[model samples]
Target chain A: MKPSDIFPTIRPWVEGLVDVWPAYIIKPQFASWQVLHILSLVVLGGVSILINLRLIGVGVTNESPSEVQRNLRPWMHVGVIGIIVSGVLIGMANAERLYDSVAFTVKMLALVAGVILTYGASLPTARADGRVSAGVRVWFLVGLAVFGLALFVFAGGELVNPGVWHMILAAALIVLIAAQGAAPVDLSGGPAGAGRGPVRGHPFHRQAGRLRAARPGKHRLCLGVPGVDLRPGGLAAVHRARSGERQAGQGHRLRHHPRLGRGRRRRAMDRLRLTHEEGPRGVGPSTTPGRGVRSVGRPGRGR
Target chain B: MLRDFLVWLQTELGKGPGEYPMSWSEALLGSLNFWGLLEGTHLLALMLFAGTIFVVDLRLLGVTFRRTPVSVLSQKVLPLTVFGFAIVIITGLALFYAKPLVYYHNIWFRAKLVFIAIALLNILLFHGRVQRNIAAWDTLAKPPTAARISAVASLSAWIIVITLGRFIAYDWYECGKPIPAWANVLQECAASEHGAASLAEVAQ
Candidate 1:
């Protein structure tokens, strides 16, 4: 039920994992392995701090938010690779003991989540236009807080219990960071009255300004609307009116969907009815009419 | 009749929760030769299982290859990962069949299965909501909410599954007292005395 109950049996096995080439690893006399391990720890630890700082908005304040992100981010990945490689090497020196140590597992998870979140959240938007808005910055802070809390909890776990609880906390922290990283960031610039609103520049930012300025058909092009809100039939009515004006001919080059504006589809349906009634004499389908039907088997058959 | 079957199972497959040396289902997995193939395949299966997990987890965490685009990486890695997964499942089944009872009664092993189930369910969500947004992310700065959550869940589940898998090697889950680490000095807890001592300490 408790960790102590399992440690003794696991100790020898863990020792084996850590002691395979004790000369290269555990021997304080060898100095090299310990040095690598410490170096990895310091580097990973430092990067973790910086990334957390950036997340908290305290560290990268001097740089444009994105610049701060760009600089602090790459190190996060390097730190992860270093920690993993070094941790494994050290653990291998005393593989058996390290393998079974709850302390080690907790450390691994903290590192994993820390590296992942730091790298992921700053992943430039695919549009190459992604920028950090205030909301995104807040998520970064959340991630940073979670990461630091995880590290502290993990260190405490190692110092105190090095039991199931420690590993559980570490895992929880890492998972939290990863969760925050998955949020979307809108890179676009914003609309009027940015105050008392959702961070205005994200994907959902208003398309209202241009729609109002539209000289017919422009609203249709602005599918991603930011501020403009239309009532149930408002958009349709507006569309109907603009399309009606377009039919009057201002020589606008826009591809106004005639079908939507004045229900051209209804007229098309009427034409189809006339064609069906008059049959081949109507012209279009009558000219070729599915050649397969006449040449192959049955007439008036469609492909 | 069902009661009799139940008693029979209790004597055999359905042994006590903390039971061990409860006998292997196939004794020696049906002779040494058959067992060797099973073990070898099991090793291969493990690689598959672990590899898919690594890739999926990496993707979820956004730890991607620099040379490979996200969509490309996903395309290339996913198939192998899924293939490896299939190998693991088949191999795992073979191993389990080779000795169902030990696997069944092993508490840590059962816990591993539970985590794997959860991890698998998380994968289902990954496929459903998250995967759908792959094309859209390029146009939009960020993916949708559902994708983000699925990715996080996938990453978390894999970590838990890995941790639990590792736990299988560490925890002495079969015994009531399982005086494992503490018992480094004393292997078993045959008597109630050690269990009582543990019960007291844990109580405190």
Candidate 2:
């Protein structure tokens, strides 16, 4: 059955909610609900930005992605809960108007997609400390493609009407994705280089290579690569393996090195690992470095 | 004096379909769908700006990020906050320029500006005084009283600003409507020729 057919059946129940005392009291104070809704968005959006930044190797590079997610998860929970509660009140008060609004339908669909992506894809990838498996990455991209197609089909070939509210939602999504992809390239010191190709000539890649050459055994903390291990044991093993090669001739001790601080070390390693992965053979960046290959870098980076 | 200046600006900018019609820039921004985009950008930017600031404020208040050093958290998050604020200011001004007279006569918009001023002053207090000595308490889970107080003030001011901003969309006490005397005086409703005409009607 079409949504047009279903909405009528649901409208009476949804509209009935406003007669309840709490919703009824809030019906007149519509602006208050709007305020609450925006405030909750601030919390949610803020926390999401931080988490996504961590996943893509931008801000708070010192902490593991999991740690940032763990610490900020409570705020995200608060935001989601508050948004839902306040949204329900507002929705009930204006049930009739919303039922006819295509923007409303698009918003609900987008919300469902957002919730699923956050929990299913984003959080899991982050929790794994940015080491996304190839399969998961493929599935995430597939999911996004399907969602976009659904939006297109749902709107009957035209994307949605170019209404202000519709565009706002679309713009927010674009900004979030763009910020994730572009930050590594734009922010000079960020670890993840552009994902599309072997950025061997990029200054960050050169700096990372120099750093790795200077220190053989210690792998730079490359969260962007899949095979490189960030765990303590894996790190020690890589150090042991590489130190064996170093013992032949290159004997150096910069233990007191000013540049070898924890954060710098991690970033250098990340760049070096990414560069190594995108070698002269022009292998693509990891299928799922964190969330998806698209998120890690723009399309057609290999060229 | 302020109302007179605003009235002068409104007149110079012009309004309506008279010989001295609305300014081209104002008309373009006001009439087009682009105005809606400007408003949406302002709102989205406000979320980013306020959200990031609240994170920093929470850190200062010792409400969250207690384990993370105060300096590190500030260093990482403040850049995003600054970026967000830059967008907010640009879009906010564009929005104001689109309807300068409407905003000038709006009580809620006026209140929003007052709180924005307070928020700016609070920032100056923070960087000028509180932050200069950050090295002293850089690692503390709870910062000094001055720092905490600054955080509280920042939060309170911005919350009021956001609420007032949302209230601007409502016409509860619009200029032409019959408003309380204090509100009319605060809004300087008698300053503009239009406002004066409306006030005179209310008096009658």
Strongest candidate by TM-score: 2
**Which stretches of model 1 miss by more than 4 angstroms?**
A1-303, B1-24, B30-40, B65-72, B138-145, B178-198, B201-204
**CAPRI-style grade of the A/B interface in model 2:** acceptable
lDDT of 2 by residue, B153-187 (tens): 99999989989989999988776577777778777
| Alpha-carbon lDDT, every model | 0.44, 0.67
Highest lDDT model number: 2
Expressed as tens digits, the lDDT of each residue in A1-303 for candidate 2 is: 123444667866766777876778888899999999999988888888888767755566556678778778889889888888898888878776777666566566656666666776778887878677776676577667656644654555232344435545756655444333221122222336444321333333454556567876433433243222223344323332332233332223223346588776666566445544444211235443322222222221222
Per-residue lDDT over B9-128 for candidate 1, one digit per residue giving the tens place of the 0 to 100 score: 434653344535443444445454555555545544444455444443444444433222346445534654575578667767767655444444454566678778887887776777
Lowest-sum lDDT 10-residue window in model 2 chain B: B192-201
RMSD of candidates 1 onward, in order: 23.4, 11.2
